[model samples]
Target: MGALLVVILALVVGGCVCVVWADRGGPRWTRVVAAATVGSGRVLRRYQKSQRREVGGGADGDGD
Candidate 1:
């Protein structure tokens, strides 16, 4: 019975530690992060579009 009580106490303490850690923002920092993520995604899209060739444009020097 003593060993069982020790095990239960350990489990309860471990759970409390986990709760505190999570309340401290376990790993996600999205809330405090800047809006640069959205801005950069737009910039990347524009860059990709600029690299693409137009439908009427051809690689050859002649239009015949």
Candidate 2:
């Protein structure tokens, strides 16, 4: 389990590095990875925002 976690962390960190490299003009593969990383980041952000809205997402305490 720990090894799996480490691998996942490594992949995420590598993907982030690829994103930076792609932005600055890197290999073609890096561009693909970077696009995937960015798309996933956007999806994650949207999911988090929706989750927040489902849980205490109102200032006036009037949420349904």
lDDT per residue for candidate 2 within 1-64, as digits (tens), equals: 9999999999899999999999999999999999999999999987877787778554535453
Which number leads on lDDT?
A: 2
My TM-score estimates for the predictions, one after another, are: 0.40, 0.81
For candidate 1, the lDDT comes to: 0.55
The segments of candidate 2 whose C-alpha lies over 4 angstroms from its true place after superposition are 60-64
Worst 10 residues of 2 by lDDT: 55-64
Q: What is residue 8's positional error in candidate 1, in angstroms?
A: 0.2
RMSD of each: 19.0, 3.8
Q: How close is candidate 2 to the true structure, as a TM-score?
A: 0.81
Give the distance in Å from residue 54's predicted Cα in candidate 2 to where it truly belongs.
Answer: 0.6
lDDT, residue 7, candidate 2: 100
